[model samples]
Target: MHRSGSTTHSLFLSPQHPHSERTKRRPGLSAFLCFLAVLAVSLSPVPGAAADHRRPAPPPAVTAEGLRVLPAVAPVMSCGDVTGVDLRRAAGAEVTITSAVVVSENTPNPYCEVRGTIAPANTIVVQLPLEGWTQRYLQTGCGGLCGNASINYGQAAECPVVEDGTVASATTDMGHQGQNDGSWAAGNPQAQIDFAYRGVHVTALTAKALITKFYGRSPAYSYFTGCSDGGREALMEAQRFPDDFDGIAAGAPANNMAVQNTYHHAWNVLANKDADGNDILLAGKLPLIHDAVLTACDTLDGLADGVLDDPRACGFDPASLICAAGQDPAACLSAAEADVVRKLHDGAVDDKGRRLEPEISHEWGSELAWTLFVPVAQGDPVSSEQFALSYLRYLADPNNPRPDFELTDLEFTKEAFWETMQSSSYMSAMDPDLGAFKRSGGKLLLWHGWNDHHISPQSTLAYYDAVRGTMGKHAVNDFARLFMFPGVEHCSGGEGPDSFDVLTPVMAWVESGRAPASIIASKIETADDGAETVSRTRPVYPYPAVARYDGSGSTDDAANFASYTPKREIGPDYKWLGSRLYSSDYQTWCRAEGTELVCGQHRGGRNWLSREAGR
Candidate 1:
């Protein structure tokens, strides 16, 4: 969320700048860990940490509501337009944010600038920064951080809220424009630069860097925080640029890019245009079902605060809401509608039972695909999905005109989705090898909401299991952790209490050497249920299990969400010839063609680590 006064805007399209953000020298584990330690202390405000905004600022580029904002400087300004507003020590570095504003980078075609903000702008500049760089720093709302998705909605900014409360703050918007459905990236290449990889990476890096710049050194520890696409960004840095941060918080990341789009595309086919071309889950219907969903799962956590601590264990079936012979038609689901949701929630299965890919869920109320990656809700489809299925007869080649968003409809067919689109485009978002990251003592935090209506939480679980299949569980536990939130939607905000600060356990593990076992999720009943409590504390299972209590609490509590650790269930159904990425056995044989480069030489799940794995 941004400060109270900043306005927001939006445009679409894509970028420029061919020089990659890659580092020539791979950092050693010790040097990497040491930098993190310095970074940690740099950020925490000690009793006498000096007047954080102690130094003079560059200059006040914009004045709104009497706040001095240092707009983009020379180098960055020259790279593109003065699109973002960064409020820092007009000069020195304290990492505290005073205020911020996002403007249009004016890129063209498909992308856009959303809004952004971080509090006490002065101290913010000092706290976040990677490799001593802070280009256009600011916070983002909804789609703000999700590769410029904020253009699709509205973000209510506010005063800064910190964890330590000393000089702590949070950010929204990466300081650009994209309030509506336009492609700002079409005009400027630099805007594309900041949007695609620079924005959050640099914001975080600069924040950490300035923290050190202000305190005469870095923090005793440092960490990265984000979810969904942000989670994808975090993992991208680790795999491609491993030395960026020591501790990272990745929740319900959108890994497996190909699969993500495919999932959503399929849903568009189902939810939007029914067999008769009628919409199934309409605008108002979402909230209706949302309320029903809550009614069924909220109390499972024991607390009636209208929050479900864990949805994985809630076990509320859409079928339960099916309209019976005498039930109220308004509240109950018709068999056809219930079937639509069941398909929406379940992984794809074809007429032959073959599993398709994964997409996010249908965001019950929001227009953005917040609920499911692909909200094919048995209704009229989004403009983009409409083009995919009918493209053969409706248009030119996939890349000919390049539809609307980053990836278009025709481009999402199974073949293009999993193969070409993923590897060739930024949208792939697949999990890269993190062996080197683990060796460097890097800590990763992965979280998934049992009811994550977006990219199915199962995808995260499957990804985690894939990691374990190759990384060795104990090693992963030593540095990586996964937490599952029940009833939460997308990144945060839903029927469940969606507020948490995981940087707590992340910092502990990085500097203090304390790895977290679990974090408590609270479900407060703010309604008349007063004083009622719904709480659950579940193990932060490293990978496979996204988080499930032992089925004890109200079944809604994290405590009740049992752990879903699937032992290598090698049965006739699932032959464990080897890790999917490595083995060439009959089971993996079907799934390993184009993705084979990521597997090991041994070619079987057992020897995934063989020389061939990293190929």
Candidate 2:
């Protein structure tokens, strides 16, 4: 996947050089931790500390009444024309401006689309509305491994919001030009750094500087939005640069980055393979497993609308699908197939009950997609295998730099898992502290589909809990909110209502001090050829509050539903794996004992580090 779409334009008017904005070499663990400590203090507007001078004034309104007073443009520009503008920056001569043209709006509003590259590798685009400037800036996120900047749907809803309000929006490829290819980061250190955190951050800063030059004033407010890896970027902005965004909306954040792509993904792929190396859990059997899961749990939330509103509470046993003596393998799952589903629902865990990663909800909404990585037909490695192999071959193993590394060379034991974590410290963003973000008056809206298979909703839940545990519940609620979408898969689309406007509520909260209690989600009923018709709407309440039926009337209408606070389940405690990247308040005996067989200690309990685990 090489850089595609429109070709780049010449450097127009770049005021600052890339050299001026150049980042230092990636920090070591000790240096990064120390930098975080200083950053927290610097971002916090606590008493006695210097006041934040960068905090901008309230943005001007772009209301119809206000638009009446604005001046109209004399000449409308074309979509691929940039006649007069300078954009040369010091990063290097390699950076090129691909295009700068006016995009005709559906609402008939016009905006300039400025596209460019950043030196060695980085595709960036900024869209500046020609009128109705709201003094707000938005940077959307890229999905998967962020190989392409054009794959950003993070701002799907945001584009309209920004256009309507005349807000400027920008997006970047996150340092590569392909999509879902781990090979892009194979030997590229700068690309890896950009993927890890730099790309989005640089884009945000560069976009803002360009916006200021275009509009003669900086944006009053800034935001970052993304899901999946984009979600990771959103968190990275909030965590690494607390002042970057006034509001951030992250969905299904792959914050446990390296772990998910490596160990967790490997665990899922390995689960599908049998003793003879045959994949019994083929795509054909998905319906069987899905029906079994739905039968046991679809009605758990007071409605049986082909979606599980609360899969976590539904105790569906996969062993029930195990065939009796007379049943055929095609009709009923063999013991091995049932075991695979069980492991997926149970999540990745060591010999002990300790969860390596959160359980991927293997319900009706997400089961079909599970077959994507199962090499049932050709015995070839799937995307997960490709990703894992690349990570192990290039990034994870310091000595083994061979690109030809096979999936079989990788081990799945606890020791092997710990070893992988050791080399991936710079990649993962599992840090739980959000005090800096909160104190900086940054508002965070986190959401994840309950039926997400790519990244577990439980992982997001765990992260939210960590923030709450580290910062008190009330304190977290003051600045951050979590909305769990039941039955939605990955970022969107599933058995449940997946379409919703999280951005509107988050922006309202950020600007007006009003918090969002619930966001309405809708599922459209499509015709035979997939043309959308009427939609079934429902309100997605914040975490702990689920949409329960009102007992009568149309179940499809959101009016018949109400938010109900369910009894809270005691979720996973924040247990730290002995990754040099992961921070720990307690010690793991496996790090001390060097084996899981004899490891024993107070699980999830906080304590001082032992000499061995401390290493």
Candidate 3:
């Protein structure tokens, strides 16, 4: 996907509504029909049917489910049909589709476009160019595993895997199905292990193969981009298959899967009460809180701008919104209810002294409760939530499942930091070793939002610091760049500014080798219906130091945020959580410094985010 020229714009909208549409089942092909069709019987053999076929004379009956794959030249097995699509004008480049290629014999999953050309010399190709077109991979919003649950455009749970013949793209179902990634590899630990290991290995092989088939040669450069769980995936690739992509863009990755789920369960528990013991506020309150928050914090950027330029600097308090006596029974949170927000925003701890992690934002709970998260107070019976709890359960145990999201202060203890979560524990600190990726002469563009309620932007800084800490700071700085957005939530919706394609500079850094010192992040404008409306831009600092806006020129200009130097020197200050990444015992020494300052280990370590958006 190429960016439009300056003053031009493009918007990609996914049309499929999250799972609300009822699916009609089609009667599958008949088993008897296969016996009469000679070609179908020969090529569509079921798995493990080799011995039977090798017999002096194969059995007369053949089944699609019993087919074994052999090399294309092995026999005259029936070749699938293919279709060609005209994409030259579609991509605005000399793009071509040889034909739709169906990789499977039992199921006719046809996909067209053997290659895509962003420019005359650029082509993202694929192997197995077909003779016809059909759907290559099913799409879903469920991250990791595609759960039966559905979401919408405002809240994209996940993006289904599309084998649309790019240079290389992948979806694992995370080893299970029903998710945007189709991580069809859940429940089975072996699948998880493979997903963590061989999954990347196999995918790299497939991508290389596709690059060869489409461009007549393998790709000299490749990249990966994803947010939340996708962030986890990006890191997974770097750790397990670092050589595949030259650069990667991961946003708020859900690394420590196990504990994150536990934390979500716990947060949902905390969010349960209304002033009256009987009346409970539902998940719908999240957006309400989010809107209120943006209203209060958006102007902090000094432009009356509807974006939050610095969440850390904003002093708005949740207590300010508490319901006054008799202010419409259930409309607003009571003082007690507000306390929930405070402790939740602060983080959770159980009666046993164990602490449950908090959502990236206090407002994340209210929004996700109804907007995207699993609700316990609802008939569903899960407790505790903070956004990512559902994905964790869906990927780890799609067949059975966790007890929804049960919450207990006892479960939320000091020991519960992040290291203990069986599923999402490592998520908060999944910085991979990029020594090889950097040594290969590659460059990376990493960014996140500071106010991100989902995966905290702090996680991004932690990962970057790990790279800088391990490799020389200047060395990592040579090929890697980091951007932090101040108030963006999850990805897009926040009070601070939120418009601008962060990818352009990344592409520039990779292809042109013009290392980026910083990037300009923007938010929407009041009259943003026009194309060039993404006119606002803010300079983002590299690290340690921050971009402070100078009250001059248009606040919309990136030059307004004067660049400052990083304060944290390239030295040793970070610490691993323990044998586990989120271990309570392993101290950042920062957290030990206590939450007196804007940052420290106890405050949960390195704080970072994409330009104007929060990580």
Candidate 4:
């Protein structure tokens, strides 16, 4: 997977390069000096003091018509004393406390870090603030195979509770400690069950138990946030465990796992190969395709901002990029290369042209990130090849593992497509019925990058449309919203403002009953001296509405933009072989029984072989 190292900065426009009249006013020298003096006093460490127990002031309230603020609670137990508390029987699963100590190094505030493992093998780490605890619990999702215990708060950079370290946070390694490859699931039914949905549920329960024990009260609000595979985990929570979190932010989710790995990713690589087994399209021609796409579609939204606001409306054909006779081969693609490019963008298709996955394979502006599937050198394996091969060998068919499966063995026909989706209910999270979550007052904020290289942005759109179809549009609108970042890639980083705070809007929506109208996303550039400054700002609106530039102000300023409905409407349900999986009837509940895992309808007498063969 690709990643960006850009530091998340303040959302406000920079004073050095003011964009409009709405830019924040710069502070005078006297006021700045006074603020620095106050900050120095507050941060100054006490001599011979073991710990600093002072709490920082909470941020301003979000005022609205029906605003309800979640209260903050102080810790009742000392940081060091937390290590002595026993919870072997308190948590639903058997628990072990490996270590508990107060940590203040390289953090905004002091907190007690608790590291432990749950029953079987679910490693978890929880952080409880020693002071200024806002009765809120946040659990982050993991990416890839999620075999390492870690916590990331990048998605919540704008939330004051996370920025000030006033919120309790925790994360888990799913189950089994191994490399990101699917080998962790081979011959292990319990670990597969844990990774599918049980791991997150158990971890949430255990973390809340610890928070209550340390604070003498349960948290008032809880939230979950993640992107990529983490995004899949976020949706799994909403579908499987509706009562777990009050709010969820899922970004570029990989929810349709079975088809994504078996066909979508495999097709990305196989489609680019010629009959001679030579690579048809190389990495060098990506820029040529991307530039052509921008020239054709960048201004579709009434602004020339190097991004396509709605790529589905862009009808750029790859045949136009085909090289003419005696033209420079270095600058243009050959006919064969152009066809390969067309196949990649068209997504996985059967002999009759039916889609294997939903919608387009990859968006137009995302050609640059196609390096994930396109190889720079002949005979070199791409990232998608490895991802697909791994899943096929281990996680695809849990009951009948194919440890020696190769990428060449995959088939893309209608029959083969149904074969791949036989066990989809086990790992995929494409369930569209979120009625339980909506009834529980849980708000879902779904976002995806239009230029994501790994997962197609259209997949997210397909799922969102399915949700709206399952639940009435008006009912879904009150509890769910989708924001599509124009030029952003998988999770973050691309040609647009990729850094934004989704947590703040979700928190406001969950606690104050105020739905988000728009979110400000920023692109921060870091200088050589470690100083950070905002270079660009844009306001992204909910789906079906896009940011339109006011003709008078700078296009770089968010204040110069307003949400406008698009002229074209998104299509109905995607024409895919696995589209039936979107229905609730395809959902399955699995549990480990001795050495075998049983699913619904065939649990009593039928075995995995008979069920799969009959399908």
Candidate 5:
């Protein structure tokens, strides 16, 4: 079929309520007669029709009740007909059908795009192909407090994948509209719920029902995929609603939502500031740190290409970079500058000397990117400043504007720490155990860049280890696997090879039972003419297994490397507060695994909302 131009528009609000007008439209006289004639013959009694198991079933009809009939080769639904289709309540949500049309953006297939808003402020969009459907439904998740339904699932820059024209896709606007604004959650209980979890769950159920109506049968398999905030959503689907998807691919997940945003982001900003309150970490200093790290640890895995194969094994000390006697200011860090590096390696800690978060030591390569979150020059608010400000002012305290926030304003008292933890509990996806998800026969694939500057990759490792501790390593590995790229940053580009396909492997595992042992990742070099060439390729193994070189072969080729399991290191516990909020299922799983320490004991606590709003 010929492709059409891309189309997009907001949904049209009808005067009548959606639920009150479900399928009340009637076909014209000619179309009604035709439908009646077909219905009569289909309903006519056949000789032993119920017992005729050998007889072939009639050809599937391309039309359904309450749907405007169209040829399979034509647009899936007319704009006029789409606005008229009634969207009744599903999963206790009343959704308004706002806009619908067919979109074709230089693809082999055209698709019907449907946009709607679930009551209480959540928007969802679903796209179904007109032809070449593989009988599969794919729901894409959002990124970083999503306020818009970015249709960025199939061809995201971080983990680009070949799109299957037969697979349908959908996305949601996670409750509100702001590109990094957290003030929308203020005093809106239902909206907070929608952003945290309801938005995705309700969107999936609605999309699946719509797919059944359009294609005349339910999809054979369902899948979910996203990175960053989308990655958190993927884990949420597996943890909170296990039966929604058959497989999930999560990349660089911000799963520890509460702690990562408030505690971790604040810690990074403060660490970069000088004693005089100036942003001393300049862009010019990044290369020096990166080079020092590479000089010290690049050959740990038998290569010297400037990328750390496994940075956790590298024990580089920033104290070594302290300026010696008669050193140039440009070449070496002064005592004050060196202190910034030390705090970055040390991470967050309370006054009592207990660690609140793990150190992000692998961020040396992407130190320049850290400037985005924090101010690089005077008068510029750090990137995390606004996000943390909104979270604290609106979600944590409605009365105070919190206008005079300084880098030193963040304190780690137990009262303030628990306040941050308890306030955002309704919106986090930090639970570790996946017993219900595993029981549902779901498969999950997770990946993270080691040099990720946005969310520390170490946090992901901690969660993975917690999962192993809670459910046993073998049991967790059977249903979920995590792959780490050596120098990749925050789900996308870095010094190491980052581009790879997670969708194909997850699909194969779900449909054909082929679990991926090691997926080959490639870094493509694009020429001036836009011609792409694969410059490097490496096999990324599951967690705990590092890729080691064989004796004497082309180092660039993946065939020269083998998977080797490294010895686990015993480190200090971070004692993150969010881990104590898992459901009873996780507690039960920990008990069954003979790890009672994994179960959460502090189940009782003071209500966060009971405090003064101005605090």
Candidate 6:
């Protein structure tokens, strides 16, 4: 591992340093202070706790092979005793255990909170239950250009194991400490590699070693869960480190990173701007557009619910929303605004109209979340611009970084599209082959909100189709299943039942060989006094099959819905400039040589199609 110009000093204090040595000598005083800090963290209210709470529905009990119950016993050594467990030789790097304390305040059970760092950087936090250990381990992934260390299981709130705090969990900062800006990647190939895939894998190895030391054994089952960038990490684990986990739950993954940040997200803002730099579509008109779309296609699944079962089936043309002569601007869109909406839905294109990404960018019911790209006020930069500009400046081309790159320098032409794909092998997780993972008995539960405003749900659909094509549908079905949430937004939002649990289902599938047919999703409402209640519930089926109203009960209940497969297929092979990169041949294995990063094709083969296929 090359360490020149490393940010490790600024991010983490070396365990051998005087500051750490001094703290270790005064364990009594340090323990009390650390207890207070952990108490505050345990007591702090989680954001969106009321609105996002999933009503507890315990998974069916199962007695599967390899299931082990940890003996009921207290720690053989004191909490502070683990600080002396040197792991440098075992980890193949400098592993520092900064603090170890028992945290019980406002928690389901007392647990040991261990904080540490891997050589160079990579901060990690692992929580081991003090009492009942089910021999289960859960490692979470971070979002965006992860610069912060935090543990979030928002996607697995309904799982009894996680809610009860019996399962051990861990998370890492991906080797840097900063804001979401891509500044950490500049002049640092090691940090970039950690952020891409190494951080999560190293964290797993370190955490497992610690777990074995603490419990006298290793976990019986291991799992990984994340959304957005975390989702990308989940797929990366299955693709590159197949034995790291037994099950994975990925939601709205930004797996098509290189092209997604460069073109898909950039085009969202660039295509909506007029020549004078003013937004062609106003944010104020999104509600009206959403309502019009619902009026035109809401009942396609035989229910007039707020969500569209399949937004791709929606043929609600923007031209239908164009205003007549002298019509109120608030009531209908102008011709230019209508055209902008069309281009957005059609995704990014070259000068000759070749697609840069998948055909669909933003989905039909996702208009309300368009505030991500649609400017709220004149001269204000939209969210997508910041996301795209960061990648273009630091992570787009590994061989040539552009720290001074501006938004205006981004080109939507075919030549510029291939330039972005140059680093896809390192940053993106689009490879479809999961043979190694399947052979290891890993179960994958992939999900994306149909109305996801960030990464296109079509990308997930395309990857799922590719896996089936590569490994054969029957073989893939045994280990993988994709569920598309109709009215949900990126991760969880939009006017739909967004709260659900894939963790419990994946756990069952991996342990008991029982696959999920449908997962019930809920729409929760929080009252002013903080009382949370479920407003609606719907069953979300696997891809291509939708929840249709059964016609005899309340639509708000999941029982009234049944799975129905649609006649029209969702995503065929995408006709795009970077379409050839989806194959395994484009995947790369990268290494650090001196201070620079070098990469070579993992498959060492060429894409069957010409690199400039769409051109």
Per-model lDDT:
0.41, 0.63, 0.42, 0.76, 0.64, 0.77
Q: Once superposed on the true structure, which residue ranges of model 5 sit more than 4 Å away at CA? A: 1-80, 154-162, 361-365, 373-379, 396-407, 569-615
Clash tally for model 6: 0
TM-score of each: 0.56, 0.79, 0.59, 0.87, 0.80, 0.88
Candidate 3: segments with Cα more than 4 A from true spot: 1-175, 179-187, 194-197, 274-303, 320-333, 352-355, 358-410, 413-432, 470-472, 524-532, 565-615
Which is superior by lDDT, 4 or 5?
4
Q: Roughly what TM-score does model 6 have, to 2 decimal places?
A: 0.88
Better of 3 and 4 by TM-score: 4
TM-score for candidate 2: 0.79
- lDDT of candidate 1? 0.41
Q: How far is candidate 2 from the true structure (C-alpha RMSD, Å)?
A: 11.7
Candidate 6 lDDT (Cα, 0 to 1)? 0.77
Minimum summed lDDT over a 10-residue window in model 6 is located at 16-25
lDDT of 2 at 77: 43
Task: Encode model 5's per-residue lDDT on 333-397: one tens digit a residue.
Answer: 87767777777766676787555666553355555456655454555776666656656555443
lDDT string, candidate 4, 1-615, tens digits: 001101221121011111111112222222322222122111212122133468545433542311234566888888777767776544456787777778777667778888878878888888898888878889998888788777776556546577667899988888767667888787777788788877877788778878888999887888999998889999998987788889999989999888777798999988998888788898988999999999998888888888888788788899998888999999888999999989999889878887888868899898999999999988887999888988898877787789888877887777666666766567768889899889888999999999999998878888888899999889999999999998999999999888777777777677655677777777767779766667777888889898888887788877788789867775545867667767666656677765566666323322442353355
Q: Per-residue lDDT for 1-615 in model 2, tens only?
A: 001111222222111111011011221222322222121111211122234688655443332111112332222344454424444442322446676766663433567778877655778877777777666777888877666555244423523344253667778887777635466655455666666666776677667766766776666677778898788888877876677788889989988776777777777777677778676576678788888778887777777788877676677777888888988878788888788888866666666555566544343457866755655564765666666665666656433356776666666555666666644555555566788888888889999997886787877887787778778989998989898887788898777778665665566566545566777676756668755543687777778788888988899877688878866663444454533233432212211111111222333422223332233
> Residues 231-286, candidate 1, lDDT per residue (tens digit)?
76666556544555676777667654334444444554554445665666544455
**Looking at model 4, which ten-residue stretch has the lowest summed lDDT?**
13-22
How many Å off is the CA of 196 in candidate 2?
Answer: 1.0
